[model samples]
Target: MQVKKCSLIALAISAAVSQMAVASQQSEAKGFVEGSKLKVLNRNMYMNRDFKHGQRNGTKSYGEEWAHGLITTYSSGFTQGTVGFGVDAFGLVGIKLDSGDGRNGVGTGLLEINDAGEAKDDQALAGAAAKLQISNTVLKYGNQMVSLPVLAISDSRLLPESVTGGLVTSNEIEGLTLNAGHFTALSNRNQSSRDSAGMKSLDLAGGTYKFSKDLIGSAYWAETEDYFRKYYGNLNYSMPLSDTQAFIVDFNMYDTKSDGLGLSRAWDGEKLDNQIYSLAAAFKTGAHTFTLSHQRVTGDGGYVYGPDGNSTMYTAHSMQVSDFNQENEKSWAARYDLNMAAFGVPGLTFMTRYIKGTDFNTTLSSNGKEWERDVEAKYVLQDGPAKDLSFRVRWGTRRTADIATGNMEDLRVFVEYPLNIL
Candidate 1:
């Protein structure tokens, strides 16, 4: 980060000023034009371990990745002060110049490519986003990652996860935010394209989602040509018991029958209803914060809602939970964090947590169990030219059988720095 900060400043002055000024002028004339709002960002990541398919799970002792991402944004200025019409566009590109097939456990950062049913290496994935709106409500359409607990955009790897479709969000109300969308496709980082083999459209239908003080709700229905009619809804609430503590509760339910034209299921291959309920409490004060969250899965199969196959929703460890490989499970998490600045150490922090799931009834076993533990720390340059630059180092270990097949015992060290340009 020290080197990067120095280099960026050296590269920013007199070096590209003329080129940038010309581009800025062109953008002002052509609103929503491509490559207008350009940014240079890089995430340098390191991992100590890789995946394990049991005996084949672990990999090289250590691995590293340096990814440079270029992003460009576009938008029109508000029209004459009153009600305005504007459009926004986003372009993202990720380039990976390191790692080989042997060291490719989990830190490769780049998705795989297929050649004659074989594997090939790739260097990048490109994604774009566009949105139009008036007032405080803007409707975004195209391919970009959307973030929400009920409909989150994933950032589990070198590049952020993305999807295809339209999303609308409104924040005109004080202390209230409303969200809704209908997606027809998803662009996972690893996949080659949006039209890959495993991707499914599921007779896509629109849905409405709203969130407000102490209240959260969503209603959505999707009809896949080959499967059942999937309807999903969720409700969540949180209130502060004091100045430093928050109590949270969430309920999620989904119903799936048949599409009336197809048979069989993908992923879990089970035809049934799925539901999950979660309760959590979080406390934050001074330099330290602690959180406790518990989740329960009921009905048959796992759960489904929105465009993700990730765990239930609204949890940090959902990326580790999936499928019927381990069923009817009860899981909980305990996390602790610290801010070094409170102790006169600026830009330094620590985080650690443990998550475990057990109690199962699946084809693999009538009884199964699994657990995961993670620890992480970070530091940022608090002063000087790199005042806002940050670096994060994370380490995680998972011990499971017939459950969670990726990242045996993983450690990731990554960094991100943002620059403000007007």
Candidate 2:
């Protein structure tokens, strides 16, 4: 396989500057006690999965579990000064409402499991970060959740993951936001102990720029010790045809290869040298939207991401149950979305999508194939006592010839309510 280097990363950064003036955020800081906020969220979730070809647990062919989560967060405004200082803190807790050794284990990241395979009844963790701001730049240190293109923390499960690190974000340049970070520890979504994933050092640098109201671009570079280094780029553009209609296009690409210590320390022991890209286009008019996308992977091995975070991959086909990522593979997807607000239902929505992948390289079969279908519906109360309460349901079916673990069907239900207190 031939790999194309990401030589344009530097060019993208240099071109991000604009003449637009940006005000200093630190200069207008309010007193810490006057500008603080605290919020809490309650989430209840249930999931069930049926295995058709293989069992996740030693003897069970199906897995089912229910759990409840409580998340509380606090953010304090910077103190009034030339260099403002503040703190951010969070507490997360999860309790098992229903589960057993045979019904739940490694599949669902809702609870912790002991060495005997018995799921723990509860888990909790708390963390905080100290921050300082100067001009339009902020520097933070401690444990926190990060949201960068190359090193994002996964929040799809019951609880979001976290990392211990130091980060610097600069908005000094108008229309451009720059980020740099060094992380040394990781905490999984299910585990309460920090560094549970046993991750080493991870370093990242990136920036995003808004050229106009409808055009944006980003580029990033990341390195994980004893793992792989990755270069990523993204471009998004939107064109308005009318007041209620628009066309949008998004392009994402990544180039990855072995870093120091190379594949010698990789979990799968596969050589790391791959390139992947995805392109998606969508059209919307009124309450309905339609989308189509294509994704391709090439090189010595499939694309890989993280001891950093599982949700770091931002490809178009990164679906609900399957990533559609495999060596020498190509995938295509079609999707439809509908907003019920146009039909007089303000907080209801529906979505469905299908993806097909082919030409995957595997030991069992070189030209393997796989497919997935997913459907989701969600609604939120718009008024009255249960105003901000929401309910969501998702169903997915995945089948493969020789590309994935096995055939599976999954169903998940979530109910959530949030409260604000400051």
Candidate 3:
């Protein structure tokens, strides 16, 4: 049955491509063929996670792995007409370079594991989408990656998650954009097969309106079939204090409630009702930006979303290790960012943040407390032979007071080179 489903998807994509080719010949597709773009990104990723205390399940005390990936993307422009047509596709390939006995687990999320508790050596995943445009409104169908306030694709590992669905977007009014979609299944970052069991169906709609030059407002809602419903709202404002100084404020909120059978009720054997909110303020002076933020989660459950392990929270402290989203949790963070352009070095940047959370509802301790420190350094080549090449290093440490064996240190090194094929 799975093979049949895969074959059907492949056939559908092939049919779409064939129809696009035929349309290009009939319509003067100069824009479609000439304006197309292709690019391939070569990525090398290495990750290490060291447990400060003894590991759980007697598996291993540390996890480490290295992988290389090639991601190729092709985007074609619409044909010239009142109603245009186009197509887009992406191909991903991941090769495991090193996954020793202690590192070949699902925790890394870089490779898939088999029944024998061994990670796959290599894997490939691909997807394609067909699109139609009429004026400022566009429609897309088939497999694709989507990013919205309530639903976002995860790209934290060798490959990003992709979903099979149809979406409609429009920007008919100036400074306003609207989006709506229905997705049936998703292929996670580590798996090559699309699975509908995780989230049977997802329906989402949202809009963003730019109130002014420095202020924007957004609202979104999403419903997962037989699971839950989620609503999100955001507000952003910025003001220039002087020629070299500015201040910005951002506020975000989320409301979640169970629906239908409430599948997530398995977590606590009760209906899920949660509210999460965050507020952040930033002050920028020349090359330095300082930020302070606060976030809180209330009610019986924590923030709920897909199971992709990537956060869609619009907060300051959602780092690589923890989201600080425990039930009845309140967290605060202070962050600093430095731009190297001010110090005569371009395309280099550094960021560090510390977050602390308390007032949890865990079994270990009712007033559990945890803290995390995250640091990142990145550089990108601007010009010359290696233009657009980028390198990044990320490190994070989490310490917990009430939870046993929960302290961990994470480090990752990522390098990428993108080549334009067209």
Candidate 4:
């Protein structure tokens, strides 16, 4: 294995040198500026009780909040050359503010529970990366976070999502952009396990996010062995219908193929063809707005897959509504958001929504249905010691079939501060 790796490395080096010689390219750095930023974030969450198996069982079960983390980032602005050279540093530390026997994994981090077997809070972790910017483009490596609807970096928990690989973003064309990356390794949200490789995932493809003054769209493709290969796209439009109201419409689609490797063996490896499609629109006036969305999925039974290895159609059309988690399912979501800034509360907001899914297929029971409702509100301290600081509180209730994870309740409170490190 070592010999084969060496051979591959040698081949890559040879190819690189051949290109350098043929083009007679000269290497040099450009510019010379360095800067960094720091963010101290703390999320204190509590649960009134956990709901399970379609019932509010764990009624008397609740208590625990704590996951205070800090992130320090640094970046250098290119060095003179044909292709600019630079680097970025990402340092993270997660401090457990509170925990016990029942709340061990309450917050987030790449590591948890020391050898002592007890949940310990307040510690640290860090990483760095190298970057290069050339001709309206940049390439990054080391701990990275790639964001997309189909592949969004979930930093909603404790630590910001981190990955080890290469990523590139180019905006050579005006109003048009391109993003591509290959992430073969990841250190998910929390827990102290970094040696496991999620599998080699290669991603390529791009699209324009802004075509004119009001039209926008994007598309991409990604593949991870044993997981699935996915391609998805979305288009958004906005228009002013009157002085006080506007219109918004969005359309999206997704196509995926699975590879049986992990606990998620492609249910129907050979004959698997699943696609998700959805359309959503909204009307807004003053401090009030109404949203209506519709989503549909068609495919063999095992067409979608989510967290613990389950099929899902939530690539898009995912809101406070019941998370799209069933194949051959149709779902709908209606939500409302209000900004209280007009009432002298410039930093307060509220949101609520309901979603339902029908025509679910399962073996234990051929037909089933599911639904979810959520309500959330947020307030931000605009000035004084907590300037720009905000807090969000949300509660969600869900009900599903026996085969489903079933009745669920989630409540969370998060606060964060982004400090500039020049």
| Top lDDT prediction, candidate number | 2
RMSD of each: 11.4, 4.5, 6.3, 5.9
True-vs-predicted CA distance for residue 403, candidate 3, Å:
4.3
Q: What tens-digit string does per-residue lDDT give for candidate 2 at 1-422?
A: 00111222223223322311335677688878777999999989998888775645545667888999998999999998767899999999999999975788747667888778888889999999998877777778898899888888888778889899878787767799988777888899889988987778888888999999999999999888878889999999999999999999999998888887774222246767888999999999999999999999987678776677878898899888888778888999999999999999999999999999999887767887999999999999999988899999999999986844557888999999998888
Cα lDDT of candidate 2 equals 0.83
Which candidate number would show the highest TM-score if scored against the true structure? 2
TM-score of each: 0.73, 0.93, 0.90, 0.81
Instruction: Give the per-residue lDDT digits (tens) of candidate 4, residues 123-153.
Output: 5556677876555566777766666545555
Minimal lDDT window, size 10, model 1: 21-30
Off by over 4 Å in 3: 1-30, 307-309, 403-405
- What would you estimate as the lDDT of candidate 3? 0.80
- Comparing 3 and 4 on lDDT, the stronger one: 3
Task: Note the Cα lDDT for every prediction shown.
Answer: 0.54, 0.83, 0.80, 0.61
Candidate 4: C-alpha lDDT? 0.61
lDDT tens per residue, model 1, 1-422? 23432343333333323343332322333333332454545554444455564344343444444445544444444332222334554555655555554554344434354454222434455655565434445556677666654445556665555677666665444444555555566556545466332335433322334456677776655554444566666676777677656666656555555455435342356665555555556666767788787776666665544334222255334533232223366777788888889899988999888887778555555566767787888898977887678888777777766454533676666777766453
How many backbone clashes does every candidate have?
Answer: 7, 0, 0, 21
Candidate 1 vs 3: which has more lDDT: 3
Q: In candidate 1, which residue pairs clash?
A: 51-57, 52-57, 53-57, 202-223, 202-224, 203-223, 227-259
Cα deviation of 391 in candidate 3 (Å)? 0.9
Candidate 2 residues lying further than 4 Å off, grouped into runs, are 1-22, 263-268
User: Predictions ranked by lDDT, top down?
Assistant: 2, 3, 4, 1
Model 1 residue 339 lDDT score: 87
- In terms of TM-score, how similar is model 4 to the real structure? 0.81
Candidate 2: worst-modelled 10 consecutive residues by lDDT: 1-10
